[model samples]
Target: MNCTSLQELGVDSNGIGGKIPPIIGNLSSTNLSKLYLNDNEITGTIPHAIGNLPSLTDLCLDNNMLEGPIPLEIFQPGWLTQLVLANNQINGEIPKSIGLAQHLSIMDISYNGLQGTIPETLSNLTKLGYLVLDHNQLSGTIPPGLSCSMILDLSYNKLTGQIPDGVAGLSSLQIYLNLSNNLLEGPIPLEFGNMDKIQALDLSANKLSAAIPAQIKGCAEVEYVNLSRNFLQGALPSSIGALPTSLHVLDVSFNRLTGMIPQSLQASPVLQFANFSYNNFTGEVSSEGAFANLTDDSFLGNPDLCGSILGLAPCSGKHGHFLYIAIIVVVAIAAGLLAMVCVVDHDLMKTRLRLTAPSIQLSHFPTVQGNATGKKESDEHPRISYRQLVDATDGFSEVNLIGKGGYGHVYRGVLHGGTVIAIKVLHQDHAGEVIAGSFERECRVLRSIRHRNLIRVITTCSTPDFKAVVLPFMPNGSLDSLIHGPPCGGKPEGPRQLDLDLLLGIASNVAEGMAYLHHHAPVKVVHCDLKPSNVLLDGDMTAIVSDFGISKLVITGARDPEVGEASTSVCNSITRLLQGSVGYIAPEYGLGGRPSTQGDVYSFGVMLLEMISGKRPTDVISEEGHGLHDWAKKRCLQHDVDAVAERWLPRDPPSVLPFGPPRCEMEVIVVMVMELLELGVACSQLVPSMRPTMDDMAHEIACLRDGTWRKYRATGLKAIDQTKSKKY
Candidate 1:
């Protein structure tokens, strides 16, 4: 190839793997303007010879596996316009000469192991607009003369000292300014109030102290603020409560703030997530506006704060104290009178008590059954009547049905109040007693458990002939639809519409939900019916675990008394007399081992594998025999991800071209796929004891979601080094 004539070499976003050949640098094309070999699995040190391309204007070797210090020689190109080497393992300090590239406008070297103080010469890049140095080991105080036209992120670093006052003059700063998770201490710079257009500001997890300046309200466009986990003292400025209407999140927990929470904050309509926990605030906790929907979890650790919120004491007044004393006197007087009357007419009183006791005892049965239904209802989730639900679902029309399960049909409903909801109606049958019992059990479990990844039970309706569970409407439908692309009915076609990050995110969410059920919730729940269809997706594509129809409550050292006779019937119904749904049941569960957390883990593993490989477990038509786990285990042994990747990736040459959407490194994808398959194999072990806990599975999936699997692998490699270096 005549290399001198080449102006560009684009091999980005393909399934290319392995190290970038050093010989490519031999091109030395004087006319080369762009080197687009990014988003591939190319490893090893970037060839220093590529610096010889004097005309190269853009270098895009990002999101790859290349390591080692960036070649200082690359900075020789004065005409370089953009340099994106982010999300790689490249170490060593950024070259001081980087500022020599006068035309450079973007430099992102984030999420790497780069160390040493950020070079002060960076301030010379007048045209630099985006400078990201987050999630690295960089130390030293933040540089002072950074260009105003940049989105500066020095978060998750060891930077110390106060923020530079010069930063306040940067009128061009508009996007984000994050200096969180650092060792920085001192008062927040008053100049920060000058960034009128800044959208997000996160200065949390620092040693910074002093009251938040009232001047910060000047940031008119700021939408998110997180100043939590600091030593900041004094009451939160009242102005903070009145921040611009654009603000959505304000978290200032773990501080030394005192006094009543600003009532203005309670009135803020746009604020969604606010935390004031672990503060010295005292006063009546208002249940108006934002506080109306907030639970006690948001205001815990403040003993002096009383309110109408559940789990909090109601405010008491002088008159209330007098009323309590008067009630006590009246009760004492009535008891004495009753005792004298009983003594005078013992036989007559005994006969009257016998008649009344039976009626009272009969009423206690319904009270016990109601208690079995779950915690008391709150205004946030008021009990909806069967009639209201019927009207909301248009008299249970089939056209409104969104899904179906053994419990009943899930129909999309719009109430008279204009609230969209998902109403899950239960089937009334000869097993009326069993259905009612299951409904109570479901209510018990759902009411007691609350997490971001767990489905929220809005309200429930029960009648002699019908029962239903109401939940918030999930617009994105189910993870099953997003994973398998749905079965006809005018759903969008082609790819499953899930990218690598999104798929891992979904898996992580499901794992998180399972982990919470297994270990963190008020009661240990085993989601006996865990499958793709049971996982719903919200508008933000977040996966929430749903359908706890057959979930079992596990109590340590004893069986749950609440789960009594009803659970036995539920277990039979859910396990399909023994085994769960084909392709998703644990091996031991089929042998009458009973529902446990390990069973849920095994089901998650199978669903995870099925998601990666487009084959259903029931369709076990592979040469490996058994099901998806067996086939994936065979593929894992062969160390070939392509066997399963073929089911998801486009095979046509045109579709695989460089200009296509960015893809995760096929090599990284293979590693992730292999690890996931190994997870399946581990969870599906014949002996239940050999399987990993749902907690472990959840952690692993979280690691994969955040791109930390490689770091953990690197740490494991170091452990090997430590073992080998030890004396024999």
Candidate 2:
């Protein structure tokens, strides 16, 4: 513990026995990061000591007999992901405050004595995928919108009332769903038919009645199903057998079901087990295909049944084989017609979009042309699939996610060939073009412009149900993290403190990117949004401005791209969510002025001031006014520049001081901080005409980075101060 960083402590599974406690001394640290004792027989209450590890991300106490109420402190960590307290004797109702763990993707508290209704606040966990609270005393109807989960096991509970329909339609319910042995009643929701990827579904031993839903044939990937021990009556829908060739196991025993066994089940290629016992069914059951090896145990109690199988009375030709053939023919024809309609509708949609498509001419980078199959053709970066992204990011797992934006979430991924990329995946819940438009617009902007300081696209993965933009993963994350650390949980990447020289360099890089967009690119563009979170730092700490989902594209007939006005109104931007970050947004935008290059300059100025002041533009210094501008102006006049910056400064002395030679105590201050603050004030003038151009600002920062401006600091400072004195 003296020299090494204590990252993890694991003494799992019988390493400690009859335990009243595990050693608590090793848990504490000066720079302690992770401490989790998983899978051990550590007895007594769920430890209050676990509350000590704020950095703990995954706490697995699985298969233990820990007995007591789950402490309120368990869900306090903002970054906690996997919480496994399964197979324990833990009692007490789950705290309503469990919803505070927003990043939680997996929560397993099964096989316990907990009571009370499931907290509806679980819907707030957008990233939650696997939730298991089975074998509890919990009652009440299932809380809905858990459609975000791929696995939901709430079996062996006192859950009552009709099932909620909010969970059935989404593709995320692809793995396994179990809600058996409950007091659930009423017909299965019609939305269950949309579970296209589910391989296993279990809803046994319930009070459910009424007819089996026929729309369930759409479960093209179902392999195992159990619908036993219910009060369900009426004919089993033909869709049960039509549940794709993937069907391998079926159990619908112990119900009041009446009907001939579906012939589709007889022809199932992979079906290994079938149980239709204790029902009023009176049809000839075929012993062909998957049912060939089954014994009479599966059909025992059905006295009226007659089939070709071993222990049942043989049926005469009066049952009519042609009837089954006719039913199969009708089902086949209907499926074919449905697929045809889907293809036609898809083509019609493509036709409409193509008619409105803008002609793109990407001069520097390769142009990606969308083909009829919905795949884009490009050679620069390989085309990846939804599955590849799933594997790369561990099924878009919460742990790999680097940042979350309004429209999308970004995850760090390593491709098969070892190329590290940031996968910017749009949230799928948003209907229509809200998700699609963001993907298209960002690609449109990234393709048209190329700059050292601007982020580049590394191909894209797009399908009807999914879309993601691939870009190089920055080892150092966004500038927002660098300046202010994370909003919660931990410190920023790399050094905890940033020197003024590094800040100056970052500001210069941003200006260069913005200047190129406004002046040098083929299409004159307005970066409608520019802020620190959108500004990422790469491996060498080079700043890159990104996220152009709402950028204004100003294409015109002029041969010189920079000289022409926007052919379309700047307000016709793609994303309707937001123009830019509040407080950083230009004053003109709020007053209904058209977007222009001056807006970018104003944003860059605000960012520059934020870096120098170490305070966000949103921080209100006094009742009179808010923002970093007002705060810095007051600080400059009162001369407390070092005091504000010294809070974030490291132990090292200032390395890039502006004044080169020894001077008086007053002159010892870094003049660059003051000049940059003045520059921020100048460019953020309320009057758009008064703001300096990005070109001038870029040049000014570059001189500061190169230390060439130090010779003329006196004149430069005087000019900036005069510019700031105007009626802003």
lDDT by residue (tens digit), candidate 1, 1-728: 46668887776644356887766667746788878776555789888877777887778787677899988888888788767787679999888988788777666677789889888888888776556677789888878887735356777878888778776556667556778898888888888778886766888899999988888887876777889899998888888777747676788889888988888888887676688889888888877787777787888778778877765556887675466557758979999999898688877867777786521111121121121134453334565677888888899898998776545678999887787889988777554665666777677778678888998877677666778888888888787777766653357423337765567788889988898999999778888878887888887888899988777886677654356654686676554422113357765453335878888888888888877775666444212224565567655447666666544443434322321222443555566777777887777654455578888988888777566544634544555455557833
Candidate number with greatest TM-score:
1
* Candidate that scores best on lDDT: 1
lDDT of each: 0.72, 0.70
Clash number by candidate, in order: 0, 0
**Regions more than 4 Å wrong, model 2:** 1-379, 558-581, 621-624, 634-650, 653-669, 708-728
Q: Using alpha carbons, what is the TM-score of model 1?
A: 0.46
RMSD to the hidden true structure, all candidates: 25.4, 23.4
Clashing pairs in 2: none
Q: What is the Å distance of residue 313 in model 1 from its true position?
A: 3.0
